[model samples]
Target chain A: MKSLIGWGVKPVDSHVNEKNDKAWTFKQKLFLGLTPGQYLGQALRNPFNWILGIIFAVGLPLIAYRYFFGLGAVTHASNDYPWGLFLGFGLFVMVPLSASGFMLGTTVEIFGRHDFEPIERLALLNGLLGYFFAVVYLLIDLGQPWRLPYPMFVSFGPAAVLFLVAWHVATYLSVQVAEVSVSFFEWIGWLGGKRFIRRIAIGLTVSGIILSTLHQGALGALFNYAPGKVHPLWYSPFQWIHFFCSSIPAGLCMVIVVSTIVKKTMAWRCDSNFSDNLDRCTLGLAKGASLALITYLVIKLIGIAHDNEWGYLATGWGAWFLLEMAVGVVLPIILFAYAIRHQVVKVARLGAMITVLGIALNRLNTALIAFNWQLYQEIPHIFEVIIAVTIFAIYIVVYRFILYRLPILYSWKAQPEEALAAEAVRPAPIRTTPSPAGAMYRKID
Target chain B: MSGISRRRFLAASVAGCAATTLAGPRKALASGTFSGYPDGMGVLVDLTRCVGCRSCEAACNKEQKLPAPDRPFDDMSVFDETFHDGKQKRRPDENAYTVVNRYNPEGGAPVYRKVQCNHCNEPACLSSCFVNAYTKTEEGAVVYNSKVCVGCRTCMVACPFHVPAYSYSSSLDPVIKKCIFCYDTRLKNGLPPACVDICPQEALTFGKRKDLIKIGHQRIETHPGRYVARLYGEKELGGTSWMYLAPVAFDQVGFDPTPGNEPIINNVKDFLGTVPMVLAIWPAMFTGFHLLAKKQKGHDDHEHDAEQQQGEDGGEQ
Candidate 1:
């Protein structure tokens, strides 16, 4: 019967119906319980929607063209560079960032670090959206997008590293979905569903850790097939270890980055538990990230040493490689250490941003830029770039959609006594008065 | 009780280690590298004897039932067709099963080299395919089944020769297109491929793989001045079925000389070895850590409880 706006703190009514009859209808909830005019005003006001509008204008048509004319229409379609930005960014960059799900799941459930409980759902949601969008990007890139499940039920090539990646990612996507569904159930006021998931939470988290570990590593191992193609500086025999280790920092830092964004943009959605514990969690994650960065740095150096490639550090590619390490790895490591020691959350946030960029650079280097070091570089087609950015924009829109309605950034407010009373009596006093802040909430609320 | 428990834990860990070691998945690597099927048919291309004729290309095009080229086979002007990168050389692609490129040496006469699937003893495309879409038949042809192809194009990345080309233009039935050594029609019947059979200059010599290696070496040995000392593909990428004795260095003739002797799959074995270990160990090990943390917490509180008991006993005394 009460408004959901600024009702972030509890002791609030659970339903948004005027007569307090039942919960808000699905359509009402979708519009955030706002009138159609208010929803349109909100959509028109935001600058980000305009950017998304332009992207879709160009990209959506190109995407349609791609399907009608084939991959050749949007991509350079060079046989020399079989993989372009679609797999390079979509699969490689996105998968590591999505590793946050398993990282937080292990911290809270397996290790009993309940201090991390507040942000656990956020990390899981970030992971789910990242992976879900990665698959979306893949769908755009695949020649036969419809036949994605052929490796699972129809055919088998168990010996390939990609086979391992295909199987593990498929399994892990389900694991992440199950892990995040608890929050979904709570938001929908399904207490029974939440309780059932809670019972299987540990098993799901364990499988998550297992699946995340293998697939993250397996992605790197995919490059092993091209021993001669990739630059030696980027390629290593221990590439799987490098990828897995880097993802640790990548995952932890992503949580910091997402939390910072949520705090800045939508602090109204955050409950005290999330908003209050966020700084402490940032520092905790920074510490974990620093440890991972150091491990990643060492293994990377060790990889070079193992291959007797110390001489490469002086070449042009080596300089480029060093730049990647300095910007993506070393700079973040220093910032994270300084931030953790000084208890400065902002520096940690900055480090997280840099770490994210660094991971993206690393994946792009491995999959595209530094790949085929001896051959001429292949630039992504303009439409390909537009389509990729457009897909990512859609990802952000879906992510924000869920964050607004779900119990991800905040706990669901469940007033059981009010619910019981509403059930017992009909035509009760409706608490539908909107707060002044609800005006802003009503539009983009 | 502590000592006995420690002994039991150690025994359990050892037994667990042994069980995993014994029950480990069959070694995908370390099963010994394949040396290609014995009596596998192969082609020995003697570059010194070949003229830059397009008969083999035309035969391959016709035998494979490929679509007509923009420039017909008789048009020598196609040789001057430069790609976007300005390299006039053409490699194999979806429409063409094989191509002959003319490499103009600085002083010597122009040398023409034919490029097709090398069909390595351990074909990277076959190993990297997750759908089992590729097969290296015992007859030395690396063939593909498009019905099972998922179109991931990992084979495109895996092929050191860059032989596999995807039909990205065909949305309805896009698949990899490459030379198959005429496996279904000729090689299966113990006859040479159409390209080898149609080489009027006798540039391509078809024979058993081992016999070809011997012939390649003998040619290089007898005609040392005419041919390069090394036979390309004999030890490259664990020995492809197609061996070449070029007049100039292999690199000069458009062959990649830097591919290490080991096959591409060998590079991935170390990571594959770790998969089972992580899959087997992570569950119990993490659960153990979880239980240990729980026990440590309980033990800390119990220690405090014991101290209180001790104080009560002291007061009673």
Candidate 2:
């Protein structure tokens, strides 16, 4: 892709190809205005594709084998350890990281922070795909994958914490899809749908906040069902709050981490707006993450204090818990504070990377590692690990595919035809002086 | 006293009272703490009387029509079966609904503890099920409807006793297999389960749950030296239908001793209670924030919608 960009082959970012007056067809957009040969050439040239290929080669068969032979064929999910990497990593970890959607939605839409606007679509897309794949991971983990909607449409156990998760995740996934659809609508040239989404954007963002709050907490509350099973160091009376609070930083840091990755790997796909605003956004997001990390740390301590679990802090597990706190929560706090103060986006980016890992470790520790601490530790079956990795790899591929084409990383410039049509309709002759974005489009056209 | 009168002396708690409080108490029985059904049948298993014979295991297998086990019920070596690096004793699995393991408590003769579903007043398995697959019946049996089971095994994760087992090998139709207390054929028919019917030594005594608690206390009182003072399931995790009279301390015989009397669902109620509040409060609160923030936007976002058009035009180059 970088090589193609260097070759002066521009990727599609508008309804029409700039050099030609003709509108870009759907096929042309899908291939990023490149011919089939050039598209294939880039895909095959990237070594990441080969790595994904190898993973799919091994993991796809195991996944099929699991469905054919049953979950026992691929997972070490026994009666005692019912959830393995599937729920521990795929659902628990992915869901929190994907919280980037709601956090950014709240900042940009709900809080009207236009400064954070540049990466809002990327964050929303990140949330949508992360959750979509989390559900994909869930389907693989569920015994009756076909009955995933049974809780919603069939039999509803409205009281169970999991029922809340099922309903919220399902609903939030819709909210996120609607939120991210602005970019999709722009790409597909569906101006009406984009306008409609814009009108109801507030409703969607509000609902996103409501659903994300309950469900992110609900995932933690699922562990509340097994109070005795989860080790006290990780367990808490406020487990849900701990989960909810930590997710704020997790979500913010995730945006920073993802934007950094985008800036590093796919700079060509990013327009000036995204590439230019990313550093400021990283620092701004780091500030939010630092505050969240501090809140999470204090509450984590309070959770232990409220439960009088200070005794467990001296044990090996306590040491491990402190390690998580020191690295995941505390270290990120210090680094973020320093980075924000110094305006060192590179340092903030490093802190964001650590915060993401810290959140993942926290969820994994609660869900799998420290779970059933009284019982012998169960290692997930090899096939289960491979399948989890494969699904994550697929998530990355889908994420890249969207970033490569969607008008998410760049402003979709108005076609010359649309600009002329707007000009013809506007009797006042551009009296509004078009917002910078509109002006950019007019200039390009 | 008759069983009905004995219920006044003790409560027959089978599931948490908190369970009904969250969802508008469709099964609300008189609204206070929901003890088990008044006439709910229960089993009092005297561990001193259990002879380590696996007859109950055999009877459960036959009654449930479960698949044959890896070892025959008559095989005493199955008693030595340990798993997960010998950290786990033989537990009920897809093939077996109950198993008797020999526990040699310190300074005591080998005590045999029959491990099965405690059939809690608020069974964690029943409470955690998202599909409403589990039902704590008026008969005091916590039964499952496998037709609706999603195979998430959340019940398995939620069961503090670690009782529910999954049949993960069945590709198209894996379901949780556990001791349902013979709810289908026997307990619902007002008869003792097959395990109780087949116990040779009367180690398993079946009667109304209140009567069983009374009888359990009487045995402890009448034979002070013969049993531990505590009834294993009484007030345990909001109490279980199947109570135990162990010869040694419960933990010495492989029971989780410190599991508090609060039902597992109580631990989750804090979170569930917040759901309604968040659903109700967040929309208004966040919308209010949006309005406040939008009010400060100074203009009705004449400053580029940003997502679609993030450029300020920066004085329009």
Name the candidate that leads on TM-score. 2
- How many angstroms is residue A83 displaced in model 2 relative to the true structure, after the best TM-score fit? 0.6
How well is each residue in A164-198 modelled by candidate 2, as lDDT tens digits? 78877887887788888888877886655665566
TM-scores for all predictions: 0.89, 0.92
The candidates' DockQ values read 0.31, 0.33
User: Rounded to one decimal, what is candidate 1's iRMSD?
Assistant: 10.2
lDDT of 1 by residue, B1-317 (tens): 13333343344334333322332364454347899999898999888777778888899999999998888887787667767577437889999989988887778998888899988989999989888898889899999999988788999999999899988888667889999999998999999999999898899999999999888888878888998799889988999999888888788877887788999988888888887888678867876775675465654334323433443344346
Model 2 reaches what TM-score against the true structure? 0.92
TM-score chain B for all models.
Answer: 0.85, 0.85
> Where in model 1 is the C-alpha error above 4 Å?
A1-22, A415-445, B1-30, B298-317
| For model 1 chain A, the run of ten residues with the poorest summed lDDT | A436-445
